[model samples]
Target: MNAYCFTYLFTINYLVVSVIEQMTDARQSYSIAIKNICQSFKESVEKVESIKKDSDTNNNNEILYNFWHVFIEKFQNEAELHENVIQETKAKVVTPLQCIVKHRRQQISRLKAFRTSTDYTLKECAEKVNELQSNYAEMYRIHREILQTKAIKDLLNAHNSYVLQLHMTNAMKAYYHKFVLPQLMQEFEGIVRENIIGFVQIFEYFCSIHTNMFDQLICNINGVQLKVREVSPDSVVSVIVHNLNKNQNPTHWQLIEYLSPDCDCPEILCSNQIIVDNLVKVELRDKFSELKRQFAELSSFMQQNVNIVDTLKTLEKRFDFDTQTEHINLNMHDDIYRKENEIRKAKIALAGIEVQESSNRYATHQEMHSHSSR
Candidate 1:
């Protein structure tokens, strides 16, 4: 009986110890799993923190780089603006001044020849006078046309410059207000106004010249009939003059004068009492008709050359302000295109960095979990 009881007690105690050992082993495994999980979580957090720090550093660096790049870009833009202004000014003022100087020199030589002639035959003297007059007329025509065209071009340039300056100044003001005025600001309105006023004065002067030239052209045409009648007879000349007045008004006659040879009729023709006046009238009328036809052909040829409806086509092919303005506008458009492209590239680079940072963060979290499990 005693043996049986001791055996049962021992068996029960052994079973209880086995169960307790199993429970302790299970608890130890659970503790180890929890410890590993906590370690993995800590490592993951450290990795995430490191990644965040790296991302922050990278973001800061990128910001600094972008800031420096923007600063450099602005500096370069400012320098380019100054360079463009100088080039534009030179093209507008210096180039035209040089052209004017060269034209004046040629005019002076022709005037000198007219002043220095000693002895000449009647024909030679007339030819020389005609040559002088033709040169003067040509110079006057060229100068007048060139000045008119230049004034228009300069006015456009001045307006464009003013607009560009206004835009640049406004951009600068905006930049200053956004980025500079919070720390350091200065007033630039006076300087900007000075430049604008100077340019306005230049524009006003060009306008004045344009107005004067317009008035001069009107005056030049006004006395054409009187001048023609002074050199030719009333009866004979009246027919040609009337025809000229009929076919082409006074304005058209001025163009005809530019094309036709200057007729130096004898002063006797002006008087009422002239021998064979009818015959002379008929002959002069015939000549005048021929002259009108020739003038029409010459005017047509000039119009073809100039791309304008006039007898002054020679000035079109010549280098002028319009050509220069066209060139500058083309350059400005190209510059704007290039700047836009650069800005696009910068935004693309920033996006790429963001994508790379996201991919790296995911990979870093996975690596941290694997290491903690080990």
Candidate 2:
């Protein structure tokens, strides 16, 4: 019976030590994996920051778009792998450790009760020996039963699923908020800058065309006329204001005279201004059409990019990663607290048994009885 008792303690103590060691190793591995994930995430953020810097400096839309596409593909793949690791750790490592801690605590309580028993007789001891053997078998069965319980299985599934979702939420927050959103905004600004530059160039091109057509019209009329007189700035301004106030669209020649107050030009009648405006309009029609087409294309592209930014904002709000992470952390803290308390209680019980064993020696029932009688 004493031998059986020692055997039970040895087996249980070995199991407890093994479980503790396994838990320690598993936790260490998980910590390293989490560290690696954080480091990789930092690296990815830095890469994106560098890309933004490049886009700002170089203003290369093609390069920025291409890099963004490639980076997203790679980042998503890595995030999926990290998510798998989180789920796997929760299911395979966390679940088993929780079960083992529970079962070990129950075993410890039973062992302590049996060892501290004060009643001993030859018949009773024999029955106790049989009971001890039954207990050992029951311990194994209980372990298996606890593992097969619906509650344990449910806990395992729920924890794993939650962990996976938490990881995914975190990934989305990192990718979209930190990475994608900033880049999209930067790119949109760059696009706007390019559009402004394009519009300025188009305005300059049209101004040059109108000036050349004005010069040609003036020269043609002057070649046939016998006299040419310098037009006064006051006269030009009065004509422009009068024509504009009358809701008459100024001819290209009138527009040029209005634009260039310092220019020396011959005075022109409204009918010639109308003819010059018609010629200039015909020359500019194709350029204006091309500018409108380009403007529409650019506007559509800008709108599409704007939509992406808005969509990302919606996802950023929806994910609420910080709250999800906080919830997971709280649950983890609770689990750790429970497990640590269970281990502390088991250790105290084991220490008590050790003290009893060392102080009394492995005395047999007869020896214990003699000592008690004395």
Candidate 3:
């Protein structure tokens, strides 16, 4: 009914489409970020695993109850959690629903196209209207007996019916302009505002899910850490002494120190002065080199993905979907009212022409009656 409102609605719909495109891009970045984080984390964990591989071996002192094994397992679980977020579920019963988003976007485009096609008056109607007007009677005199006085009365009756239909149409126009349209716009504005609120809430909710997962993981590890702490080197030595016959008791017990993620020079952790090192360095050399390569790749991924996450965070804050849509929605009713007024005037104008045609027809009918009576 309101041209401006309809136009604005279409405009808002296009904006929504644009926003969806941007969201798709942002989601892609998020997936890549998750991928990189998981890969980097896996490499870091593997490095520690290699360093502590033989801590519990036959000839060595164990490192803090073999905690590196736990690190490997935990790292796998942590990576799996993030990987699940980006990847489709492996279950056969639940298929991916990504197609639904695409279909909905297509439907919006279809709606826009359909509305654009049907909402306006056709050129053909105007062209045919220009060819012949209803008010101008044919000059052929096919009904020559028409009388002027009888025709006036008939026209008055027709005029009343036309006025009644026009009255109804105008009443609806008034109701829509004053109440229905404005209220509909207000509700729409609220919807847009709520979407913005939800957008921010989604950010907070996702962050909390990851943060809580990591926190709970740490808590569980802390709960189990006391077991490792309680394991004394003397108890370990006593177990070893009994396992092997007490035939050969080594006087020198090499105490194992942790090779952490921060350690750059892993050679220092190896028990060797110059003579043992000269023998051969072969135990974890391959693992160290492999981890080094993986870490390099992980570092590259981390930089790109972390920057993506940061950009998206700023984008969410900077974007104002509500403000963008509110201006159009709030002004729509006023525009509609003006357009409805135009429609009312056009209806009245056409009605005047049709009423004049009724008078022309009535005169012809009455003249025939007058001639028959005479």
Over 4 Å off, model 1: 1-84, 118-374
* lDDT tens per residue, model 3, 54-87: 3332322233224333422333343224334323
Report residue 82 deviation for candidate 1 (angstroms): 4.9
Q: For this target, which candidate reaches the highest TM-score against the unseen true structure?
A: 3
- If both were scored by lDDT, which would come out higher, candidate 2 or candidate 3? 3
Clashing pairs in 2: none
lDDT of each: 0.31, 0.34, 0.35
- Which model, 1 or 2, shows the larger TM-score? 2
Model 2, 134-223: lDDT tens digits are 443344344444554554343333322222222223333333334333443343233334322332233233223323544432333232
RMSD of each: 47.5, 47.0, 41.1
Clash count of each predicted structure: 0, 0, 5
- Estimated TM-score per prediction? 0.16, 0.20, 0.27
Highest lDDT model number: 3
